[model samples]
Target: MANIEQAATYYEVKKAEDVSRLISKYAGQGKTNKVIWLALIGVFIDAYDLTTLSFGIEQVITEFSLSPVMTGVVASAIICGTIAGNILGGWLTDKIGRYRVFMADMVLFVIAAIVAGLAPNVWVLIIARFIMGISVGIDLPVAMSYLTEFSRFNGRSNKAARLAAWCPMWYAASSVCFAVVLFLYFLLPEEYANWLWRVSLIFGAVPALLIIFIRGKYLTESPIWLANQGNLKEAVKILNESYNIPALTKIEYAQAVQIKPSHTGFAVLFNKTYLPRMIVSIVIHISVAFQYTTIAFFLPSILSRFFHTDTLTTISTTLGLNLLFAFTGGLLGVYIASRLTSRLVLIAGFAIQFLALLSLSLIGQPENSFLLYIAIIMLGLWLFAEGFGPGAQMMIYPTMAYPASIRGVGVGFNRAVSGVAQATALFLLPIWMAKYNTHVFLIISVFAIVPILVIGFLIKFEPTAVDVDAVVENDNIIKNLQHQISSQ
Candidate 1:
């Protein structure tokens, strides 16, 4: 054992590092990137399937004779279901296994997509979308955990930096959804327009189904998670497959021996160590979801209303701008996140959102063509901040906010908070926008920003990739808990 330990130390100093130490080091390299890349497909599906409805919703409303309220419900149905999925799926991932959640969620996605594609009525479509939301809810926390863990294995200090892949992928998926809508709209005859929306909605299943097939071969248990379960052998295999590192020490397994293998309920979040993080995660996610979902999903319709443009022009411009600015925003968020603190990035993002919303309220219905151009410019700036800040960070923050012990639960809770915000936003946005004008609606969005700004500045901590144990020395809350545990 002594000789083996010495050899491991030698390898760490010069040759292949031990698997445990190097997991975060090799992120986005050979096998680690492959796993993360596969995991991102789940995020892509979630973003695409969930956001596509907004682009095609005008068509759905026309087809089903949906009132604004009904449209809101239909729009938010998946989010509502996702709220449940996030809670349940996170628990299951923490309790059962990551791979199991991955497999099960996609199956739900496939079935839900089929129902959505063939729905005979609005209620059926709502039910189908709700089911789809559940799948997304389950898929995200698990997939995000995989992505973060592998990226940490790549050896990046701040784990949130790895999430750069997440935002761009999300924007790309939304862009694809719009592109599909535009394609089907043009290809099909005027009489068959409803099919355009249906086909575009169902397109979510394709990538999901393909990724599902890949899970058995490419996907495996998260080594970080397995180590948590005290399964050294299985964890070692996964670590080797992920980064091609040598066998690891029994550090994780030995420590985990003391951990009870059961669900740590919501009560865990209330402990001194986790409380602030939980608060930050929940607030940032909800605020971002409310702002983005309401804005991004309704942009086309809002444009149609604002400029009084024809349907074709509105749809074309909507898709084009969402692609251009949103894609840019995603990239910016990633770049900024890698360099800046999360709190700083988040503050900047919300500030931009607030300014943009305030500007739109003030500019209400440009009197001339010049002001119209200005409104468009303001809209672009708002989106750019969104992509650079919340749009990108929402995914990153959830993964970073909690330790591996309850990552799934932590992220799921974030997702659940997001779902509540999403459902309320989706349900109320259209009705309120229609009731008051777009001007009032834009101003109302400012409300989400104030709280986010207050919270972002108060929380001074950031998440590192390793684990909670690694974080305890710096945080008084975690330190106190550690002291308590030792005393006990």
Candidate 2:
């Protein structure tokens, strides 16, 4: 009986090692690319839902006869929900498991999208959008967690930084929406043009529903999460079967034993090791959320007001520049991410934005027609700059900054901060755009970049700094050493 029990223990540990090896192997072969693509689908939906209103704000306000304050509410509804979703989903993902959250949570998004598209009034639109926001919040952290845990860390191309793909994908989603809206602008008759916003909004539900369908069939929980929970049996099964790898034996069991079991709670984020990273994460997100929300979210409206452009030109132009600059900047980020520290990349990104905003503010409204062209160029510079630094890097930071134990919570918290910043910006922006001087907001935007730059300097994100497995192993070894010394 003793021998049998020992053998059983050996088998479980060996199974765990096989799981670990496959996870690493999958990372190297990019077998996990399917999961990454799935994650991008979620992000694309979020971005489309998020910035879609930027183009349709005028139409909504006109059709509904909404006040500036009411318009702000309409603009901010999804962001407000995102704040709540991030908090709730983050906690739930950590408390439950990534697989459940990843697969099931899209139901909320599906519902939210449909409700938002069919909203009958301003009140209904606000409420529907807020509900949709909740789904976005829930999905982002878990998706990012899945990416971070599954990605290979062989160091040639840091898997961690690929998380930056979120922004470009986000920009891509926005661009797609813009293109469709432009096409429909020509497709729909003038009498029915007012209904374009409704069509654009309802269209979001189609892809959203498609993601849920595909996820139901293929999505798996992160193996790291299973290992942390001490569910090595299922963990190994996913590695061998889902990931299509083989089980291992004695030598592999040693490595499998090194992974620590997971404990769900928010306590780990406050640990000294992660605390600074947390601060940096929150500050940069807050800054990004606040400033970017103000500048980018209303691009169509902003350009329309400044240059006195027609609706088609504004919508087409906003997404065009967003795609062009954001894509270029994203590639730049990906290329330099391995060579430069995250800090320097962030500073470089922010510096351009500050100068761009400063230039825009100093110029005041583009008085001459040619200067309006220059305004567009400056806008391109700011958007492009963001792609390389803050915009791309922000999504990657939260998951890697915390150990796997509290990653969901860490990401949720970071996004919640973003939600607040975005919500505040969304809420205040229309009011400001309506009543306040443009220069004031422009100055505020430039100043906002300062604290983020400060935080960037304070952080030095080590590629291996927060490896959950390594972190736990080192702690256990240290404790064992201290125990021996004290006992002697």
Candidate 3:
């Protein structure tokens, strides 16, 4: 009886391994556009939703008669919601299945967007923003997982490159948001200016609805994730359906006693195998989030303060920087993803950001036209560096570093930390700028410096072209580790 049970286990494990290899072998050979769009459209929605309100927050404050503290709460409500969403989303994604979580979050976005657009009071608006934020937070982990699992390990269009594309999608979405606001600004009567923010926010639901409608056609449970979950039959079916792979799951005689039936929780991320990756991923993401939240989110305000610009100039300048510098930089990052290591690219990005911030500090509130121009250039340079470097690396690192079994949790935890940094920066930057002037640049420079020192000098690990998931999730490796542990 014991031998029969062991033989059955052996067959199951071998069949699962066959499914995994089949998916990896055929990953790059299929119709990839649907999968790519399905994963990335969420990122576009995230950036669009966040930016829609940026140009209209002053009006929201006036409409609601909000105090400073209440104003901060209203502004940051979404970010705070994301922190909780990241933790819970990642866990549920891994605990259940990717497709379920993916579809559910979009529903959340649609509902939240509509409610937010219709909210009549400050408290109601805050609740709506918070719910929308949870949707954003939940989408990221599953999105990154899809990007990583659906692509091959190395190529011009590898997993890293696909992940890099998210940064540009983000900036492109921001640019579109600004363009829409600018159009509405001119289209509306002076008496109806307050409706601009409400209308723009409701616009966010369009993409979410489209995604939800078409997602069933393109989105499928990740084959790699399925194989890991002991569902080889279904895993093989998805590979055949999504990847156009003619494959079969076959169980043969294998060492069944080596099978370790267990579950991986969040604590597994801190084991010796993953702690270093955890550190690197957390540091890179938090640093990028802080700097981006402080600068990109407040670009209009920052421009007005530094150059004493008018509303039109500030708006135009913000749109230009995002489209020209930030969006272009993201394209540059994607172009170089196949050519360079992610670590090297990250270090170079942080170095440029540090110098740009330092330059802005020395230049200090440009007094003349030439100095103001230089300051604006510095600002563009900072955003460009961000697009090409840490912005992409943050997604690339966690998605690639951890295996599929725990990829969601690892990426989720990393983003949650980043959300904390973002929330903190969002709350503090306005206060700091008012009190410290240009010295705030110096404080911001510290974020850039931390990544430069950590990734450049301390960590030697890089995820580019490396199959971290393949190695750690290998059945033979797991069997060997369990054997060693049992002998002890």
Candidate 4:
């Protein structure tokens, strides 16, 4: 299907710098918003799959006759799956291409959601959730890469703002999950109430399948990624399609005719330029995961036990908190990203969390309706701070910290650390809650305390409006830097 002139144009592109310049020229133009939204839909399903069990966890324990330990295992299975998925998916995204890996993970989402909903036993459910976790894990790195690569480096709706969008989408998914649970609570007969978890999980597949269908028509390869991999012609074509830029392949000449191999592997992330960012990202992600998993994942149960509320009331309260406070916080994060450093927001977030958790710990069990309302207010404050702070920064640091070459690995590694924290928190939370009741907030408060204390020291660089990838635009310098790092 290739004509002589068109085929010849593919070879006309010789310098990677020119490709980067062309992409930058039209960075915020054309179908960029549509492409970004399609990528964000992936984030929505990921958050939905991750939180599907939160509302129905008690039902799962009751239906399966599970012990505290088994309940923890079943609840944390998807998180455990993400640890593996993040590592493998990150590598594959960089090794292959973002579009291929992105498309493949969407399919996994469809399959895993279907299987999870139809699971026959606890073990089957666990397996299905684990598979779903992997899909989520794989999707995030690619999705984050898409978010970062597709947008401009600075100004309004820059990479940081775009990256922060994931948090609101994440809360949106959580709110939607709870809404579905509420609808099911009313729709299902009293006798069939236990089936709530199954149907809620199946709903996740609808969005995933819809994304798969729409993606084929709208999704294009990341031009930056293609250019990094030395595929200039394809990269320029995508630029033309997504950025409304004129095709550059027809140019008769180029600045230079040098080709550069892509820089990948986890080793580079530990080099002097990136190691600090990695440490900060991992610490914040893990801390956020520990706090979020114990609180958000167990919110329904926490409310049910603390207030002696029925299932319907617990679901409604959890839904309201997520929508009103948590989702609103996420939107605030998106709004402030263009104006504030992620570090400042994170510090504010962690400080508020520490105070909130400490207050909850001191309050103990609510002795009256007034105390109960106070406790709810504290919980809302924590979620609100988390929405804009750690939740948004956790993704921002890893995705923006590293350049395109190791961005996938950086985010994947950070996510894997968070996965471990989430698993540990989920596993220990029930045991802690049983022994300490509201005092368990004391233990959770430490996660918040540590991040506030350490974040200031660990993270010095601001990725908010910086072009981190351009730092390594010269291939020879990267090779020399890697050589120095390896030799040492």
Candidate 1 lDDT trough over 10 residues, lowest sum: 9-18
TM-score of each: 0.89, 0.89, 0.91, 0.92
Instruction: State in Å the error of residue 472, model 4.
Output: 1.7
Residues 248-365 of candidate 4 have per-residue lDDT tens digits of: 6544332233345555688888877788878878788888988898778888988988767787789999999999999999999999887898889989999999999998888878
- In model 4, the worst 10-residue window by lDDT is 1-10
Against the true structure, whose TM-score is highest? 4
So what's the TM-score on candidate 4? 0.92
Tens digit of per-residue lDDT, candidate 1, span 1-488: 12234245322211112333456444454477777778889889998888778867888888889888788888989999999999998999898878888888888888899889889999899889889989999988898888777765223423575575688788788888888888888899988877977888788899988987777767778776776666655667666665666654455444444434554477787788678878877777777777776567788877887767686777677777777887888877766666776777777778888888888878887778888878877777777788888777767766776766688888888789888988998888887777777566465566557656555557765653334523422477766888999999
Which candidate do you rate higher for lDDT, 2 or 4?
4
The digit string of per-residue lDDT tens for model 3 on 156-252 reads 6788988999999999999988887888889999999898889889989998899889877778888777777777667767777778776555544
Q: Candidate 4's C-alpha lDDT? A: 0.84
Candidate 3 Cα lDDT to native:
0.82
Which lDDT values do the candidates have, in the order given?
0.74, 0.74, 0.82, 0.84
How would you encode candidate 2's per-residue C-alpha lDDT over 337-408 as one tens digit per residue? 656766777777878888888877777688897788888888888889888888887876787766566789
Off by over 4 Å in 1: 1-20, 153-158, 248-259, 464-488
